[model samples]
Target: MTTMQLEIQAIAAVVAAACALPGVFLVLRRTAMLSDAISHTVLLGIVLAYFWVQDLASPALILGAAATGLLTVWLVELLVGTRLVKEDAAIGLVFPVLFSVAVILISRYARGVHLDVDAVLLGELAFAPFERLTLLGLDLPTALWVMGGILLLNLVVIGLFFKELKLATFDAGLAAALGFAPALVHYGLMALVSVTAVGAFDAVGSILVVALMITPAATAYLLTDDLRAMLGWSVGIGVASAISGYWLARALDGNIAGAMASMTGIFFVVGLLFAPERGLVAVAQRRMRQRWEFAQTLLAVHLLQHEGLPENRVESRVDHLVEHIRWQPVYAEQVIRYAERKGVVRRREGRLYLTDDGRRLAEQMVARA
Candidate 1:
């Protein structure tokens, strides 16, 4: 409604979208937790750079954060390569040490500065609009300019290297065999992620940055299998979360960053429950169908085996299935009705007989078995 409100929402949306771009690959590559590790460890870069330059606003801080992000990744990978610890264990081991060192440095040397762990971890987006930057003769929130630029950078990089990223992401061995340096692409992506995290973490905080990076991409992954569609969906979900989260915070008079993070979880739960093919409901329904179909196949095979045998009448009687095949009476009735509807079996004079198609299906199943 108000200008400040609009600016806050815009900044949040841009940050969310920017984070979501690389997040798609992170989710696809099964490295989503790296976002969390990088988000925390990058603080060490900022602290070190600030110590070196004694300036909070220096460009060196960004570079420092990016390098620290890459360092985090390299350290984790190095640990994993040794097989001494798994990827999760490596991330757990590396980020805490880096983040802890940064915290100690801030408390000891930078105690008088505005760089505090709480501010970096849980930023206040309501204050974001007050920090203005003049860009191209237009005054806007600094977060808007920074996150917007990062968003554009992500778009260009991902567009130019879409195929390479995709190939490397899905199959690194094949990508390397085809002359695409997957390792280079991987580090490049990590650098971009680090930059984006640094840009976003200042305004939205590390918690929201991690939430935006992983949640939207994960939610989109549940909704679609195509990489491009997943990217689009992830961006859309992020923007939606940002806008909706602003309103939620307004309604509850709560923290905007935390509200935005909560919205991402809400969207993910919705996707998990309702996504067309991969959702929990769909999976449950599919399993139920498979169970019924399998039961019908067993019924057909049983009938086919008893057809023309001395025990044909005894085994083929509809009620006899409960005892002969160990099916419950109620379940046996449901299976018979389902098979009848599918034309797999027919009940004639209370006896079950397999149709021609049912017999063929049974023979095929038998051959496979």
Candidate 2:
């Protein structure tokens, strides 16, 4: 690989990792859409910051974007607090106005300027290496430092407040009852998400920022029940998506950010189909096994019910199962064989009889019901 391709991959990986850290909690909280809202609204923040400072490279631009992201969340919460709109509705209402206003400003006043809407929506990662930052006598891509700093900040903050974050995410009522201030934790997470979004805006664009943030974490959720395991899996999945998507883009001569987003979707599909306990295939297998076992239990119960009754004895033969239970021929045969193997029923002459063990089990099953 060329140096540029390697650098782009490295930047994408770092951005993915940074976004995925808080994204786990976002997914758990069902607030994944907030990433989309904050990412888009942050553009307004960047534009306003640019107008004030007349400089795109200033740190104040990031601060403005971060603050704008926080404002978006607060506005949504405020609208929700008014009880006139739901959370999703509030987000939908707020972000479009902010984003459209920014777009209008860009077209009206900054049309001939370097800032372009297409660049903000879909970043040009190939040119990322050209924007260099010289740090400690080594020149590196600016996105690498920006994303790396955000990644470190997310790790430290999440590590320090892991317990509180967990409690706030899963059980806000309990957290509030215990004086943990769930509201503060929620807003803190929003703040971090906004900062992460801004950090990634230059490399992956605002659109893919939400993809890298939410998709890997969601895929990890399907694979594990443990939060720590989910976090680890999410990081691994994000890095894997970055690396694999880089190669995919190279192969197809396609958009790298779009390829990375597509890879995240592929990972989620794999989890949905192949996760050990919760996957669709495993779930179907479990349901089928349950039906088979229940069918065998029904056969045993039927045999026990007809035992010691001369009138019903003629109806207790194995052939009567299809007529009595309405089971398909193949299914009835399978259930009968299973019952015999379990010693729940015995065949004597042409009749089926329940064993002593079978009678006891049938009675217990009835009692439990």
Candidate 3:
């Protein structure tokens, strides 16, 4: 691979890892939509800051964007807390309006400027590697330094307050009762998300930020129950998506960030179908096994019930299984075969009878009931 390709992948990996870290907590807290809100509304902050400072390179832009992100969160929370609007409704009301204003302002006033909606929304990762930053005596891609710093910030925040974040995410009420200040932890997490989004969006775009922030974490959530494992899984998934996505984009001659975002969806679909305990296929298998076990138990109980009664003796016969137990013929045959395999039933003279172990189980079932 060329040096440029490696640089692009490195930047994508850093951006994905940074976004995915806070994303774990966001997914756990069921606040994933907040990333989308912050990503869009932060544009208005940037535009307003640009107008104030009249300089695109000033740090004020990031500060303004971060403030706008926090404002979006505060507004949604305020509206939700008042019980006047639901959380989703509050998000729906806030982000679109802010984003539209930012778009209109850009169109009306900054038409000749470097800022464009495409860069803000979709990004141009292909060009990111060309923007070099000179640190001391070494030259590095600007995205590397920017995304790397944000990645470090996110790591430090998570490392320092892992316990508090965990408690606040899983059980806010319990955390509050225990003097953890869930509200503070929540805002702190939002702040980290805001900062990460701003730093990464310039390279990967806001859409990619939202996708990376939520998708990998959500996929990981499906795969693990332990919080630390979930976080580790999410980071791994994010890095894989970034590297794979770069290759996908190269193969298709398409957008790198979009390719990586697509990979996140692919990974999530795999998890949805194949995760050990929580996946759709696994859950279906468990339920089917449970149904079969219950059917076998009922079959054993019915055979034991008719064992010595003359009038009900025919009920223990294979031919009477369907009519006596109100089972379909095919179902009755299946249960009989299964029971025989389990050594729970024996067939002789075309009649079925429970074995010694089966009789004991039937007795125990009756006793328990």
Candidate 4:
């Protein structure tokens, strides 16, 4: 509606898209929690860099944060390599120490500066528009420029190294064998993630950075199996979340970053419940169909087995099938009805008989078994 509102939403959207790009690989690689780890530990890098430069606007801060992110990954991998602790445990052990050190340094030395814990965890997007940058003779929010550049960087890197990243992610051993240098690609990805996290940190904060980095990618994973499609879906969902979250925050008069994160969760829940092949509802329906089909198969097989036997008369009786097949009367009746509709069985004189198709079906199932 207004210029400031548009600027803020644009910044949020760019940040969301930037974070979502590397998130796809993170989700697939099962290293999603690393985003959370990097988001927090990068604060220490910022503090140390700031102490060196005595300037908050220095690019050294971004470089320092990226290095810290790589360090976090290296430490976690080192711990995991020992086979003593698992990956999750390693991350839990490493990030807190680094983040805590950052907190301590901020409280002790940078107390008079704007580097506070609240801003790092809960950034104010509404204020983002005030930090303007003049780029190519156009004035715009600094967050927009920063996140947009990061988004472009992500696109170029992913495009150029898509195959390498994919192979390394799905099968690192094969990738290395094929001379892809999976370890190098892995650290390269981590470096990109680090830069993206720090770029978004000023606009969305650390918590929302993790959310945008993981949630959209995870939600897209439920909706599709193709990696390229997943990346597109993730970016789309992230952008939608950013725009919708702005409106939600406006409606509730709430925090924009938190609202955006909440929207990502909402999208994920929707995908989890209703995705075509992998959703809960679809899975339940598939199971229910299988149950009915299985019951029908059993009924057909039972009728075929006793077709001409002396016990056929009693065993084929509709009422007697409950005891013969150990089915409840109600369940037996339902199975019989379903089989009849499928032209697999016929009923006459209270007896059940398999039709031509049902006999063929039973014979095949028996042969397979």
Candidate closest to the true structure, highest TM-score: 4
User: In candidate 4, which residue pairs clash?
Assistant: none
Q: Runs in model 4 with CA error above 4 Å?
A: 82-84, 308-311
Local distance difference test, per candidate?
A: 0.94, 0.90, 0.90, 0.94
lDDT of 1: 0.94
User: Ten residues in a row with the worst lDDT in model 1?
Assistant: 200-209
| TM per candidate | 0.91, 0.92, 0.94, 0.95
Ranking by TM-score: 4, 3, 2, 1
Where does model 3 exceed 4 Å of error? 136-138, 308-313
What are the per-residue Cα lDDT tens digits for candidate 3 across 200-278?
7788889889989999999999999999999899999999999999999999999998999999999999999999999
Tell me the deviation in Å of residue 321 in model 2: 1.4
- Looking at model 2, residue 257 earns an lDDT score of 89
- How would you encode candidate 2's per-residue C-alpha lDDT over 124-238 as one tens digit per residue? 7777889899898978999898889999999999999999999898889999999999989988999999899988888889999999999999999989999999999999999
RMSD of each: 2.3, 2.3, 1.9, 1.7
Tens digit of per-residue lDDT, candidate 1, span 1-369: 999999999999999999999999999998888989999999999999999999987779989999999999999999999998988999999999999999999999999798989999998889988888898999998879888999999999999999999999999999999999999999999999999999998878886799999999999999988999999999999999999999999999999989999999999999999999999999999999999999999999999888999999799998889998999999999999999999999888999888899999899998999
Error of 3 at 26 (Å): 1.3
